[model samples]
Target: MIVALTITKFRSFTIPFAFIGMAVLRLPLWLNKRCRFWKLMGSGKDAQVDLPADYRHWAILTTWDNRETYDDFNFRSFVMKWFNFFGSESFTILLNPLSSHGLWSGKQPFKTQISDINHTEKIAVITRAAIRFNKLKEFRSNVKRAAEAMRNATGFILSAGIGENPFFDQATFSIWENMESMKAYAYQSFDHSDVIKLTRARKWYKEELFARFAIIDSWGSLNGVEINTNN
Candidate 1:
């Protein structure tokens, strides 16, 4: 299976149209047999876990049958046409799952058999959770510190704060130069480590998913600039 995450941006004047696409684009995606799992999401400012939302940016995370199936939909479907007409810039990254654990909506969307991963290659990580309603305040209060830690870490490329619902359902998609760099931030950063501990001890989430992928292909742009994935 292939996972594709596409982030699209709209101009101020076109924001309303782009927001409407979140609802209208669902029909075609649901009808398409090639798509297995998908989520329509809104983005946060500066890719941080912020309380206020980024009105102009949105994202689509989808699991497909294969690269060909994704290409077919990307080129021939109403989704692309809608994006082209309303969006000012967009970025997409195709991923191959290296390792995945945990559940998303009670199901595992990314199926991976590969156990060994090359640590030197560019990598992508998706961390998402459905926060328990009771723990909302705790979850929100602690995430900013971790976000701040990650923003300045070495080997960090870019990240996007995305989710279906604001506050309660949240997720982050980030890229790193290599596994080592990503691991350092995940395990070594004091602020992030503290949050990790709190998450387990506090049981902040009702459901959660953490997955890592090897970026196989990427194209387009976000925020008016193309991401440099080169080593």
Candidate 2:
């Protein structure tokens, strides 16, 4: 299976149109039988979950049967057309799951089982959670510091914050130079590690998903800069 993630930035004045697309685009996506699962999400102000969403930015995450299926959707889907006309900039990455654990809305979205891939390969990580209503305050208090620590870590590339709802559902999509580099930050960074421990101790999430992917392809630009997924 292939996963396609697209992050688009709409013009300030066209924000309303982008909002409309979120509701309207669901129809065609649901009608496409080739698509296994999908999520239409809004973005955070920076690379981590934060108060006040980035009104001009949004994202779509979809799982497809294969590369051909994604190609067909990319070339002809109304979803693409909507972004092409309304978005000022966009970036998309095509991935194959390396390993996945936990649940996303009660289902496993990524199906790849290859966890023994080379450590030198570029890696993509997706960490998402449905925060418990009562734990929102604690979750928010710690996320920003962890996010800031990550940005200064070695081999870090880029990331975007995405979720179904700005408040309850939160997720982070990040890319790193390799597994070692990614693990270093995930395991060694004090702030991030502390937050991880707190989450388990406090039981902050109602549901969560943590998955890794091998970056197969990428295109377009984000904020006017293209990402080199292969390197």
Candidate 3:
């Protein structure tokens, strides 16, 4: 199974240094032998809770052939070099796809056995899409309410609004207490259902991807609180 290694950082007062250093570190990441696909992302304020844009926070989303491949880069690549120099706190999550559909930049970036939808386990969900130019207003109008629904939803852990570009391009990464809990919120909630239905019905996105993963392992903090990702 391939895995998604996503990490978000929260920097200290020296914002300029961390920002520039992170951007410069991408060259090394793109060249990493073990990494199959990757993205440099901007993140929201907190992970467990859905929040607005937080400039001090940024993230790295990448896929690897296997755990060892990811581990090698974690310790040996320039990605680590930036981590050492930044002095900010971060959290890294490893995920195994349970289910996935659609594409990311015209390609699927993950592969794993189909998940047991009824299984009770910690889970992660990622929703990424490039909003269509003509449908931008429609998409933008729906974001706030959907975010509120996520934050207050039952069993919700954390959710982050991230993107390659702010506003125009967007994605969400959220963790849940269990599959049942996540499904309930995603499928049963009115606001969320409306978002999903219209996204398909109106073709709100030019490109999009939706995936569910089992939390294989993780460490560190998302917003000063360490999460337990061993499942």
Candidate 4:
């Protein structure tokens, strides 16, 4: 069970560089040298599509064995420094492997390595919802309906908590097998339609959406706790 950990941050040179050093370089090195990390790099730097300009300032995908290992690494590593430096906001997903998927285009950070891990074409659709402060309950209820419908469709992956964001409005994250599956659920489903209608009707959002497509390469616990990994 590889979990998806997606971190998005506003553009800042110092923070983004630190994230690469700490999470991609330092953390992996520490894990391989000090703990247990089954190192698997993707195909090449062109494995996936780059995030949209608006959202490309920072992002990363890493997998983990379980929550326990993730927790251990978080408390014991320099990873927190990256988060602190970037003022990061994150969303995580726990996925059950899907047999069919889509491939991300070139331009992604770790594109090459990603293509090697899971050659089968797999696409992931990530939808982020941010709601007003007092509308948490209503927003969640609506999102729950959409999630339920999406999960019922073929190629559905497990979805997790709509975690709170310290620096932004309420947030929710979900995973899907492919773009088609996501489209069917997002566009054709009745629940999703209602959510959209309500959102537009109420004008519940204070900001526009931010999203991206990424290929997960390899992930697992650095220490022993399960941490969400991207690929």
Model 2 TM-score, all chains together:
0.96
Order of the predicted models by lDDT, top scorer first: 2, 1, 3, 4
Position 128, candidate 1: lDDT = 92
Which residue runs does candidate 4 get wrong by more than 4 Å?
A: 1-77, 80-120, 162-168, 221-231
| 126 Cα displacement, candidate 3 (Å) | 0.6
Better of 2 and 4 by TM-score: 2
Stronger candidate by lDDT (2 vs 3): 2
lDDT of each residue in 105-223, candidate 4, tens digit only: 21111112123243333344433344567765566556656656766877555443222232223233444555566667777889878888998887766553423344444233211
In terms of lDDT, the poorest run of 10 residues in model 1 is: 43-52
Model 2: per-residue lDDT, tens digit, 1-231?
Answer: 899999999998999998999999999999988999999999987324554698888999999988998999998989989987899888999998999989999999999856736657889999999999999998888898988888888999987889999989999999999999899999999999999999999999999999999898999887777789877
Q: What is the lDDT of every predicted structure here?
A: 0.86, 0.90, 0.77, 0.42
Residue 176 error for model 4, in Å? 2.5
Q: What TM-score does prediction 1 earn?
A: 0.95
Models ranked on TM-score: 2, 1, 3, 4
| Residue 8 displacement in candidate 1 (angstroms) | 0.4
TM-score for predicted model 4 compared with the true structure: 0.44
Candidate 1 residue pairs in backbone clash: none
Pairwise TM-score winner, candidates 2 and 3: 2
**lDDT of candidate 1 over 63-136, digit per residue (tens):** 98788998888888898788777888889999888888898888899988565365578888999999999999
Q: After superposition, how far is residue 16 of candidate 3 from its true place, in Å?
A: 2.2
RMSD from true fold, candidate 2: 1.3
lDDT of 3 by residue, 129-155 (tens): 998889988887887788889888998
Best by lDDT: 2
